[model samples]
Target chain A: NAGVTQTPKFRVLKTGQSMTLLCAQDMNHEYMYWYRQDPGMGLRLIHYSVGEGTTAKGEVPDGYNVSRLKKQNFLLGLESAAPSQTSVYFCASRLDRRVYNEQFFGPGTRLTVL
Target chain B: EDQVTQSPEALRLQEGESSSLNCSYTVSGLRGLFWYRQDPGKGPEFLFTLYSAGEEKEKERLKATLTKKESFLHITAPKPEDSATYLCAGRYNNNDMRFGAGTRLTVKP
Candidate 1:
């Protein structure tokens, strides 16, 4: 089972341009999360969803929005891309992400803002 | 502020050599400690999970141990396949999981 998958393995955007990242999971997970990793910085959560129709902001949510329309998909949107938004983005899923659930991560999407 | 830090940003060991990596963390509440192995340009792969102090888990050449304030990943006679960035993360009871910058390890022949 392709535990988790992300669309557009790589992307390049111009300042002010808008884009959305798609994350899909086939494990029927109860939780999904979006995080960004920058050089010298650890992965920081941008947003997360506990279930379909429920979304919450995480550690770093500025410049981003998320939607969980389907139980199998989570989308991260950038309204106006900036250089600061350029980083490697990762998506993760967990069957029960309540307290100590172990997360399964996708391959990751590398973004570059020019 | 919740934080996770890993020591010896990077380590190089001869094949068959043994070593250990350190991870220290601070959070509102500790629920679990996670260890992952990440190859360059790839996503992290889960290794072991320690739920509380005195908890330990082992896989092949890796053994993970947890304590109140820190965790250690011990590698015994590691092979080149063990060369990767080791990441330590913590999950709080509230479901907030934070990661460390990662300690890169290189097992040479």
Candidate 2:
């Protein structure tokens, strides 16, 4: 079902440059999340959406913004890239909070900001 | 604040050897504890989810057990193919899920 897919598997950016990473899921999940993974730091949530058009800040939402304009798609935008933002970003989705909390993750997009 | 911590930042084992990875969590109203295996350069793959203390789930050579404060992922007679980073996370009723740093497992064949 291509559970979840991410665009631009890899990208490089200079300080102050902006870009958006797109996440699409074919499973029709009602919840989607954006997370960044760094060495020895694990995965930290940046933002999440409970449904289309609804978004919430997560543990590490600074410097990033997100939008879920469609039920099957979630987008993460970097207003101005920073060196600290150079990490592997992952997208995840789940059916619902009550019935199934298992999140399906995308392959991840590796971002390098210099 | 809710948090999850894993022990033995990295582990190496010979083929056929058995070991366990630990994930300890501190969260209010724990709803579920999850286990995932991630390969190099790839996203995490779901393994198992423990809903309550004493809950156990198994898949192939891996078994996950949960307690009140921690969870254990037991690998039985592992193979090289089983080598990957193991991650655990905890979800509470009040907030989003929190993940541990993960334990990188390497199996030498």
Candidate 3:
């Protein structure tokens, strides 16, 4: 089974452009997260969903919106893409928020904002 | 503030050499520590999870140990394929995971 998958593996956009990155997981996890990794910066959480129909902001949720209408899908939307938003995005999911539960991750989507 | 710091930003070792990488973190309330291996441009792959001091987990050539303040990942007699960026993350019981910049390791044959 594909544990976790992210769409638009690679994309390039210009300032003021809008785009959405989709993340899907087949593990039936209750927690889903979006994170971005940049050089010299560790992965930082963007947004997260505890369960269907519930979304919460994380460390770096600015410049983005998230919707979790389905149990298996989490959407990350950028209303006005900027150079600072250019980074490799990763999707992660966990069965529970309990400590030590492994967080499965998707391959990742590399985005570049010009 | 929650934080995680990894040392030896980069490491190079011979095929048969062994070494350890350090991950020091200070969180609000320690819950768990995690280790992961990531290849270039790919998401991280889980390695081990340590929940308490003196707790250790091993897989093949890598071992992870955790203490209240820091964690260590020891690699023994690693192979070329073991080359990757090793990442460390930690969280409190609340599931607010924080990650370190990670250490890039290269095992030459």
Number of the top-ranking candidate, with lDDT as the measure: 2
Interface RMSD per candidate: 1.5, 2.0, 1.1
In candidate 2, stretches whose alpha carbon ends up further than 4 angstroms from where it belongs are none
Cα shift from native, residue A63, model 1 (Å):
0.1
Better of 1 and 3 by TM-score: 3
TM-score of chain A of 3: 0.98
Candidates arranged by lDDT, highest first: 2, 3, 1
lDDT of 2: 0.94
lDDT of 1 by residue, A7-108 (tens): 989999999999999999999998999999998778999999999999999999999999999999999999999999999999999887566568899999
Shift in Å, residue B91, candidate 1: 0.5
Tens-digit lDDT string for candidate 3 (A71-106): 999999999999999999999999987776889999
Q: What TM-score does model 2 achieve against the real structure?
A: 0.97
DockQ of each: 0.73, 0.66, 0.82
Tens digit of per-residue lDDT, candidate 2, span A1-114: 888999989999999999999999999889999999999987999999999999999999999999999999999999999999999999999988773368999999999999
True contacts kept of each: 0.73, 0.64, 0.82
Arranged by DockQ, best first: 3, 1, 2
Model 3, runs deviating above 4 Å? none
User: Which pairs clash (backbone N, Cα, C closer than 3 Å) in model 2?
Assistant: none
Clashes of 2: 0
TM-score of chain B of 2: 0.96
The local lDDT score (0 to 100) that residue A4 gets in candidate 3 is 96
| Cα lDDT for residue A58, candidate 3 | 96
Each candidate structure's TM-score, on Cα atoms with residue i matched to residue i, is 0.97, 0.97, 0.98
Residue range B3-107, candidate 2, lDDT tens digits = 899988999999999999999999567788999999999999999989888999999999999998999999999999999999999887633688999999999
